[model samples]
Target: MSFSVNKTIAQINERIRKGKAVVLNAEEMTEAVKRMGKEKAAREVDVVTTGTFSPMCSSGMLFNTGQPGPQTIKTAKVWLNNVPAYAGIAAVDAYLGATEPSEDDPLNKVYPGQFKYGGGHVIEDLLAGRSINLKAQAYGTDCYPSKLQERVVSLADLPYAQLLNPRNCYQNYNAAINTTKRIIYTYMGPLKPNMQNVNYATAGKLSPLLNDPLFRTIGLGTKIFLGGGVGWVLGAGTQHVAKPQRTERGLPLSAAGTLMLKGDMKGMNSRYIRGLSFLGYGCTIAVGVAIPIPILNEEIAWFTGVDDSDILMPVKDYGRDYPNCDFKTIQHLNFADLKSGEVEIMGNKVPSVPLTSYAMSLECANTLKSWIEKGDFLLTEAQEAIPAG
Candidate 1:
């Protein structure tokens, strides 16, 4: 017997409101497809949610400190907890990026994971309701007489706070290994000499972009779970390669698509928005993000059913290729091999570790599923599709 099934976002939202929508995480969706076949699974499962948590350097927050008076100040410079924030906006608005280092950081003396405080830490402290030292400087003007100001403020003190990340949730990333005789530090973490270990990031089968490879379900204005709060997709992220080399299964072999996201920081949880510092590298934020895929057709079901073994990743040497901006594909491997503890490289087996947290990803997926099941979350049609390559 042949099966033909199709659904719409409106239909799914109605089913969710009536407490009849069948939702599953990406992992469960993969199994359901395998057991019942693609067409049947597509007809039965209304949604497949995915999640990922990892160090994303292209993340930051924008906030506005309430003006004390009309003649208080027109800010020309700003710092939060001694970390410099971009004050090019309105009088009291600033943007603190995740990779921005502390003003007191001695860059030359910094080592891997040694430099602790940065923009990421500041953001975390604010989210936890901790007071931060706020300072600003400006030349006195006719309407704003104050030249400088200093105070202690928490998240509540700020009239507005929004997390606006330019790039997050990389579709797929490279697995890094060092081919040199000395240890090297990179955004992927420290790689030992001569390929002793390899590092990669992604939630594997549970990654959002991996589930929606063609950018069909997730697009501009689509709602998502971000840092334990609700968020929306702004647009295509910086360095977004819409069309990259792919396998027959439509999985990219290297870094491909990305996302631009924004959310209200007041509602974010600190656990899902963490600060991280790498030895010999810089500081960044580890963000937890999740997206729900509405199964509108059989094709989307097949895309979400991809397993770890079926997806491929390009192996690159961080010590040489990465530092030189050379994207040389040293080898090709799969997440199944990496997660199994080790992978073979040049006739030698090397231990592999994932920088991305699969456990946290699973937790996020379950959280989103619960929200949908409780009728607290509803699907939205994308106002505009993300640009496809």
Candidate 2:
């Protein structure tokens, strides 16, 4: 009878031991699960929580309860546990078909991959204050040319020819002015003339001539004289030899009696004819005097004047207006009406919680999976029973 009683007592003791072991294991498992939950919470909070997006908890929690409510530790604990489970299920559902093994199959026996959280937030921040070089992209070129040169030619016969014959000047001056303006406007920014389209070389050659001091100084009458008969005479006169005269009397001698004229005679005649004879013989003579007029310099000065007086002043005034135009001046402005604490999220003001929550969840899940594979925590009975374990 005593042996029987001893045997029965031993059986009861064994069952108690097993039960104790099971309870201890269950508690450890719960603690591990809770640790994972806390980690996930922290990650999600880090990723999704922004100063702008933080749920204004005037009551000391996420939701708005104006009274400064009491702390409920139990409620928080419950929330922590539930969030992970809910997140896992939601993730599984969201990535239903995309997973290698279906969501319904089983939890992954293998550990998680690397954590990939906060990427979405990083991307959002990058996009917020970004700028781009639009001119470089659009024009496939650099900045505008700051230096430019233009020539204004005052033709001798333009006005008179247009008045009298009209047909002599085939090119319309008005049309030419308009076209030149268009060219100036078109090439106002950085532009390269298409040599293939026109005689860019001719334009280049004319540019230097336009900048010449003599060209700018020459008047209409001077240009007419230089370009017309006078020019022809001067060119032809370089080779002309004056015929020497021979006379019986003490007068101008005949050709046979007189000495040969060594220097250019008709050239001197042409210069005299053109009213530039005072500028000595064989001197470098430019008929139509050009003067360099700095068009770009004048334009830049004008632009600078406008900027200093108008643009900069107005811009500065606009900036100052922000500080001067305070709400205090308005009679209806009331401080009490402005409820300071977390205002209701609505309309366009409602913040888009960047996909940080989802990303962090993925990271947490991956971390948990890694811990489990690394044997950081013991598995369930069913999991332990698997062949790989």
Candidate 3:
């Protein structure tokens, strides 16, 4: 007799609660699938977790501060530690963008100004329990008399603080190179001229979206590990292209899918959420995100079995092509080739490095796996699947 495996997320959760669900990280699942085949592996494995740590430029936070005084002042302008925030929301609510620079910083006044601090750093400082300088300007009115507010505030002082990122955890991204004579600074870090260096951002095989390329198990309302805390997928992210150029193995060659994520700042860890600034580039935040894949059948198992060699990245010239909105690719490379430290481009050998940290990605996967094995975390069924183009 033969049995086909098809497990529901609820069943997996029950097994997890009973301390019997077989959970593995993406790396382990790959090896298991190799040894036992997809059929057998799918039946044995309950869940496979995935992770990625990369600079998500389109990420930020939302906070609501209580009425500073007795008057109900509507904030026209808001600044947190010299960094401007969008205060067009409610009375005292504001949204801080990660890429927003501090007003005090002389940006571009000097060539390639070092954006040492910005919104990302503000978020980090708040999470670290440091005091923040809050200043807001408002036009005084009859009902709301207060015009200006300034004071020191900590994370706990705020009524609500949420990490509401518009986009994070990209499915797959580009390998950036500079074809110009001079070095160029970008979010991918500085790229040497003449394609001397190649920089790509992704956890490759360990990436959450790559392990489930088709969004089978990941979607809106799916529970995830975000910034070292439990978060939920809000929806498909901005600039999300559900369908894009792909290889024979069905891996996207460009930035195909992205995620809109939200989590509570109170429950987050500072280590997983970091502030980063590239030399010539502006400010951004490095967010740690992970997703758990529940193995429902052989196909899901096969998806999780993808190796680094199977995931391909498109190499685009940041010098001109990318800046001009040209999606033209000079070549395609696999993580296996990138991890080797160097790859050949146009018959010339160039050094390759990952902008995302593989060690942190591994740690995220292991941490999520442990949460499941210890019955602290349960897999969630996506209420609605992500949109497919």
TM-score of 1: 0.96
- Provide the overall lDDT of each model, using Cα atoms, as 2-decimal numbers: 0.90, 0.16, 0.89
Q: Locate the minimum summed-lDDT window of 10 residues in model 3.
A: 105-114
TM per candidate: 0.96, 0.11, 0.96
| Better candidate by TM-score, 1 or 2 | 1
How well does model 2 score by local distance difference test? Answer: 0.16
Q: Which candidate, 1 or 3, would have the higher lDDT against the true structure?
A: 1
Better of 1 and 2 by lDDT: 1
Once fitted onto the true fold, the runs of candidate 2 whose alpha carbons sit more than 4 angstroms away are 1-352, 379-389
- What are the per-residue Cα lDDT tens digits for candidate 2 across 1-389? 11111112233224334432111111122233245443332221111100001100000001100111121111111111011111122111110010012122112223232111111111111123222111000111133211221122121211211100001100000000011112221111111122101100001101111111112211222111111112111011111112322112111111011000011112222211111111111101111111111111222111111110111000011112223542121011011111121111112121111111222222223332233234332221111110100
Q: What tens digits encode model 3's per-residue C-alpha lDDT throughout 54-112?
A: 89989998998778686678888999999999999977899999999888876555654
CA error at residue 135 for candidate 1, angstroms: 0.9
Worst ten in a row by lDDT for model 2: 168-177
TM-score of 3: 0.96
Candidate ranking (lDDT, best to worst): 1, 3, 2
